[model samples]
Target: MSLVESPLLSIRNFYKKYGDGCLFCTTDSESENPYMDGNRCLECGTVWACRNLNFDLYQGEILGIVGESGSGKSTLVKSLFFNEEPTYGEMYLASYRDGEQNVFDCSHQTKRYLQNHELGMVDQNPYHGLRMDYSSGGNIAEKLIAADYSHVGQMVERAEELLEKVEIPVARMNEPPRKFSGGMQQRVQISKALANRPPLLLLGEITTGLDLSVQARVLDLIRTIQQELKVSMIVISHDLGVIRMLTDRTLVLNQGRIVENGLTDQIMEDPQHAYTQLLVHSLL
Candidate 1:
């Protein structure tokens, strides 16, 4: 799908750090400083998970955030999903208040409303995304309920529809996620995330730990969802292969900074940054 004129979501100067900044590390400057080793501050022991992250996700576009572990790939998505608050930065959602308001400064109630209605997240771990004890259908119904679907019949039908979309058999709707395989659990998570028909979806290392065949299936499902539902997605992964297969544009992150950003094909064919070159070569 082609990107829209304006960004559906925009993040500006985003930063997330684990500790209080000391005099040696704290600075107003945005340029790379000598105070830190990689992403960690030598003086204060502060770890900057994300620093000065600026990016936009356009309508119907799949924006991939690729990095090695601890490169802030998960941190970026977690912040956007409101699981973690940014130390500093602004996030604007075009669907919310005409993209004028900073989402980080919004009231807790407003954030909850956005989570329930405007955004959906599929975690890398099924344990984090789904309730192991809940019935597969019940899980999707939970999201629908949060979206204000009060009718029991409608919720059931919607849950069934979502399950089928993810290729889960209707017969297994009553089974608990704990009883399902890892791949099946991930599929259930995908269905639940789509339950509200959210305009923006955040997938954090979703295909990690799955078998090759299962991973392909999940990737295929995501592509189908984008094509059919026209939902914009931010996919975070350490795997460049997944990013190349799924994303239209890719952001290469290193030591909490985005080192490169461009078309997925262009980035794959000719990565500029040393870290990106290593990633591309490793893929080859």
Candidate 2:
């Protein structure tokens, strides 16, 4: 499908709080701001890892979510990627049903189908995205298999093309990712994620823990791929630099809420929220 004028993904009032509601909750009525209104379970202290995470991902755009540890950035993406089931909310993907199907309500099989065909994720940990036991080519083939591509000859041809696009030497295609450096493995992960030509890609802290030089190269590769493929993306990260380098727009998360959101340059150069100001300053 071609890029649309509307957002490719829409999330409304998403919530993912662990445990039962707090003792403060006495009736069916609920506070719009449950966390601040003392709705937390008084007995167990349950809290929303992600709450009211509302946003839209336009086709062919990169949106960044930045937050500190425990700030729910991971939870938010995991929920959208269907790794974690959100408590309550509505999610729609343009590829699914003309923005009609709530992604969260799809059956397990349909969810898997959407995940395999419509969306791709390269997680912070390579293990989450790569088959450590499989050769790099084999790993890409796994994605192809999930997408129902079974022509062995074509799969090999496509896999090599992907590896080349991500700047991985085609000679290394037969080697297991374990033999590659962290940066190389990440490249392979990127290749795998893009193998299916998914409409949306989910990036989870891909540069964390890498050397600065490695991070720069990976970031460059991501920028190149997005430009070449015109894929929409949701980038999850704590580093403002990564967000600045890759995203057109960014959202700042504090205590699981969107503290601020705007163009990447605007958010960095003229932050509006106090937390966002501190976050921008921390870069210095």
Candidate 3:
């Protein structure tokens, strides 16, 4: 996990906005514009959800993105997962084309290829990540199918194995996620995300809305999976406690920009940015 090695994923000048820009709200001039409020353009009401995000996710590393609401933590991950299109950016994946091409500029089919084979996403809401009506095993089979899995027996076996990895009972594999508890639903989602054994996983607030005990179990599951599979992950959460438990490096975002980036322990010990300092103090 040396930083000197080439990154698994590299993002540069990434930006995502909700509305069309006005004369006073261009990305290059927004900082100097008098009509701008934080990440929003006061003149046009355009909200820049992510602004010039630049970061590298190294191989087999867990990178945490922590920020309060509206800090673009979720937006960054959504953009990476291709749930939201970026206004402009270059994303280079070492696993894709030897990191020579910008994925953003690639074709739609190529993006779909990346999504199916190279990436996995677990959204904060189970509704967003899972087909609640589908059986837990079916949900995982859906992902495996997308990755070209054809044998029903093998897919079922894989599903069972993944479910067990997240501590879900094999007997409940045929039950729909709608019938499961919140923690169980999240576990199923995690299993589905890992169905393809993707190298990069995007987890957006996966532990939110669960009980404290359930949260602990889910967090432990994530750690175990990372260690066992060596899958690089981008973990997005508003809670620093969750970040501290799961991340090796951390990014502190504010108003759509990354205000701080460093080792998780260092960021917790001595946060440099004012907003990050407030976050650390609040954690204490």
lDDT of 1 by residue, 191-262 (tens): 999998999999999999999999999999999999999999999999988998999999999989999999
Q: Compared to the true structure, candidate 1 yields what TM-score?
A: 0.97
- Which candidate would rank higher by lDDT, 1 or 2? 1
Model 2 lDDT, residue 188, Cα: 95
The lDDT per prediction is: 0.93, 0.88, 0.93
TM accuracy, model 2:
0.93
| TM-scores of all predicted structures | 0.97, 0.93, 0.97
In the range 35-92, model 2's lDDT, one tens digit per residue, is 3443255456776576667889898999999999878999888887889988888999
**Span of ten consecutive residues with least summed lDDT in model 2:** 26-35
Residue 126 CA displacement from its true place in model 3, Å: 0.5
For candidate 2, the per-residue lDDT at 185 reads 92
Clashes of 2: 3
